[model samples]
Target: MSTVFVVGSLNIDQNIRVRSLPRAGETVRGSDATFSPGGKGGNQAVAAARAGATVKFTGAVGDDAHGRRILEVLSEASIDAGHVRVSGTAATGTAVIAVDDHGENQIIVSPGANSGITAADVDAGLAAVQAGDVLVLQLEIPTALVRQAARTAKGRGAFVILNAAPAPRQIDGLLDDVDLLVVNEQEIQVLAGLAGMPGNHRDLVQALPPALGPAIVCTAGAEGSFTVLDGSLVHVPAATVAARDTTGAGDTFVGYLAASLAGSHRDLPAAMIHATRASAIAVTRTGAMESIPWAHEIPASAPKPATPDPATPNTASPNTALSSPVVPN
Candidate 1:
């Protein structure tokens, strides 16, 4: 199996469960609070590892207890953390999250040490990357470092997959070096500056700059996902499920998608199918990494032919048809 290099952020998520989100100044009583290991980069790396990919993580953590715990968690997930660094001046990244009774969440992040990643960090991480390996990235870290990693991975002939989350106004010139740009509906709108109205998959795909890359994947939540690759438009429907916590669902999809691509199956459509299935499973549980299901844990049988039951959500589905709007969890 090909190895996956993940260069991104590591954060400790402090989550609170409440009856509902607070309004302007109205404070609501929270039911409980829990802390978990999270961050786009770390979550995706764990997701990829659980999906059966040999994964390596390259990011910065603080010289604090949270940082130590981050490394410990990654080790438990069997992810290679040899390239992870410790920042003396900064604290580990953190996210404050609020989850309501409906499983909806509101999150605020502090980059902290994750923001300290530099080009040097990317260079150090590249030591283990090889041709045909998969290099996955996200925008949570410094954009310069993200570009450096993508360029380096591309130079090494490794497939570069970029999950442009927490989308920025400008991504420098990194897209040209990226092999796949995985983003969701809101992100696409932010990058493209299109009207607030929903758009057709083809229309959305056409809006992207032709010079960026050949493939653009737009993920729509329950509706499904859309992919434009090699001049072909493919829509992959999502496995219907009663979502518990949507956090990390997109990371799960991206992780599983990267793993499927790095593995023997090079077909993009098949990879998307597998990723969608994995993400569906993630939504049925709570927490980020804790929600991700292992490869063996996925149901062996395919989904039933009937329309998905909203009440009883199952991630494992049999249908392979690609259809639906792009919604990133």
Candidate 2:
């Protein structure tokens, strides 16, 4: 099994449950309020650990309660947090989230300590990464740092995966360093400059200019996700369940995908299936890290030989979807 390294953000998510998303300046009241340990980096790291990967996270948080909580959560998930830093000058990062009845969510983030990550921070976090390892990145942190890590990981012969969320108006040269690029429909439309691309997943994915770069995975919520493997586009169906919150689905998918590829099952198509199932399970519950399913809880489609060593887990099948009843929202 290959190790998975993440260089990203760590935030305390302030979530509000509302009947529906409020329009601009509408001032709608939330039905309930809650807080959870979240952030693209932290969420993905937790997801990968739950998916049976040996994971390490690198980022910064404030010398505050939120920072302490974030570290505790990561430790409980068995993620290596040695690279996580505490900033003396800044407050911990935070995200104000609103989830509606349909499970859709809107988020407003305050970078805080997340914006303080320097190139040195990225380098320190990636020191443990080696050839055949998997490095996962996201846009919540500084783009330059993400680019630097990607280059470093690629030079070391490790696979680089980027989830370009909060799509930048213009993609930097970092695209060239990515081995796998993951995005949702809204992001693809903006990043690809095809806001009105009127076609199915196959056409949209195929139409992307080579400049977009990397093998792509385009997710379309309940419609499932699309990816290209072995020169063919494959669609992995999202598990059917009543969604409680969609906040962490994308992170779950990216984390599970990285975990799958880091193991013996390097097949992209099979990995996508596993990722999609993990995502489906995520949306069926509320919160981010708390929602991800553990490897033992998920049933794989094809049963591979089990490893005799308890420390190392065997690769599981990708065809099996989540069959358990939905937990109360």
Clashes of each: 9, 0
- On a 0 to 100 scale, what is the lDDT of residue 141 in model 2? 91
TM-score of each: 0.87, 0.88
- Candidate of highest lDDT: 2
- Deviation (Å) of 242 in candidate 1: 1.5
Q: Poorest 10 consecutive residues of model 2 by lDDT?
A: 320-329
Model 2 residue 304 distance off true place after TM-score fit, in angstroms: 18
The weakest ten consecutive residues by lDDT in model 1 span 320-329
Report the lDDT of model 1 for residue 71: 91
| lDDT tens digits by residue: candidate 2, 1-329 | 89999999999999999999999889888966788899999999999999999999999999999899999999999999998989999999999999999999999999999999999988888987788899999999988998999999988888889898878666758687887778898887776663444555555555553445576778888767775433334566667789999999999999998898888767666777788778877898999878888888676663222112232222322211111110001
Give the Å error, residue 187, model 2. Answer: 0.6
